[model samples]
Target: MSYHNPVLLQESVDALAIKKDGVYVDVTFGGGGHSKEILKRLGGNGKLFGFDQDPDAQGNVIDDERFVLIPENFRYISRFLRFYDVRKIDGVLADLGVSSHQFDEADRGFSTRFDGDLDMRMNQKSKTSAKEIINDYSEEKLAEILFLYGELRNSRNIAKTIVGKREEEKIETSLQLRKVLQRHLPKAKEHKIIAQIFQAIRIEVNEELDVLKEFLEQIPNLLNEEGRLSVISYHSLEDRLVKRFIRTGLFSGEPVKDIFGNSNVPLQKVGKLIVPTPQEIKINNRARSAKLRIATIKH
Candidate 1:
């Protein structure tokens, strides 16, 4: 089976607006689909760097002089690039969220379709895992994760049930936790509700929001004038942050305005939001939720 299929392949690459000898970064190099395409477009002098916390992706590492694989998280994109003497890049692309391989592997516990341990850390080296969050977090904290991250309407009941159940026995596996949440699961939307719960835990385990924020903050400094950022987010929360940052240079509110009343914006939105076509979504169901946003630093 394919390790992973790239989403919005052509559209995303086009968004990069690659120059023949320009430097680029593939911040979420899952199966290297986007990176491979970038390599194809690059001239002999061009270079590409990839980041993936999962060791499983190491096998997909290409052995090209211009291609370098960093088995670290993208949150450290700037630090690692500096280590490699790469101060600026012409473009960066990130396809965020759980990779297809992670969802397919039952042992990784990133999906509701399988029975496995509740460990959802993208980086195995990371200390916090879904298992810890489920088994050790306080009731209030659990409620917050469900409500804020999962966006579950029944978050209070789910949290109450989890706290009440865990006292009798530990919840270590996905199935065990699923059973606890099953009561609150909407019968009409079982698949979606469960997926949301899994997503919340996965995000928490990987510190995805924090990582994305750090990664975004570094983009302006890392990009050359007119450097582009092409990001494909799999959910509304991620998409909203990307959209806001690209438009106003901040996540929560508008960028500060000068006394002259002109709002400060670091990156200009390159194009309207892009989504996979019906044909692409038919071939890859995962593309259904994907949203592509592009922006370029003003010269």
Candidate 2:
């Protein structure tokens, strides 16, 4: 299967406003789809750096001398870039959330269609996995993640159900966990509820929200003057952070204003929120929930 079909390919890259010889970064270089597009827009002197913590993505690394793939999480983007003496970058593109490749691989435990071990770590090297979260997390902790990340209203009850079931046998696989929560799944909303449960565990196991926040905090310092940031977030939690940061340069609370009421924000939104066209969604169902937000460093 194809590693991943790039979503909003032209739109996201165009938002970067690529400079021929400018430096760029694709932070979520899952299948190198967006990275390849960025390379096409670059001249001989142009350089591109890609970051992916997943060992699976290493095989897809571009062979071009001008391209470099850093096998590390983008939360450490600044620190890693500094190692290459890259002090400032012209643009950065991020396609956040799990990749299609990850979802299609049943053993990786990302999709509801398949029965596999409960492992959803973006970087397989990570210590925590969905199996651990399902089998070991406190009911309260599980409920909190379900409520916050998955936005499930009956999170406490669902978490309670899992806890009750696991006491008899450890929930080691996706199917096992799904069966345990069968009560919560009416035929009408079974898939949706299970997906939400999986998403909650996946987020906790990978610390996705925290990692995203860390990565966003580094962008203002990493970009050159007028440097562009194009991020495609797959869900509301991720999109909200990107949107608020671009508007106020902070995740929460209003930006501080001067006596005259002028606020000093680091990044400004480039345009209105962008989403996949119906045609694009038809081609790639995963693109249905994708939201692309563009921003540039404030002058």
Tell me how many clashing residue pairs each candidate has: 0, 0
Query: What tens-digit string does per-residue lDDT give for candidate 1 at 43-75?
Result: 999999999989999989998999999999999
TM-score winner = 2
Per-residue lDDT of candidate 2, residues 225-284 (tens digit): 979999999988999999999999999999999999999999989989999999999999
| Model 1: pairs clashing at backbone N, Cα or C within 3 Å | none
Error of 2 at 213 (Å): 0.6
Query: What is the overall TM-score of model 1 with all chains considered together?
Result: 0.98
lDDT for model 2, please: 0.94
Candidate 1 clashes: the total is 0
The numbered model that scores best in lDDT is 2
- Whole-model Cα lDDT of every candidate shown, in order: 0.91, 0.94
Candidate 2 lDDT for residue 195: 87
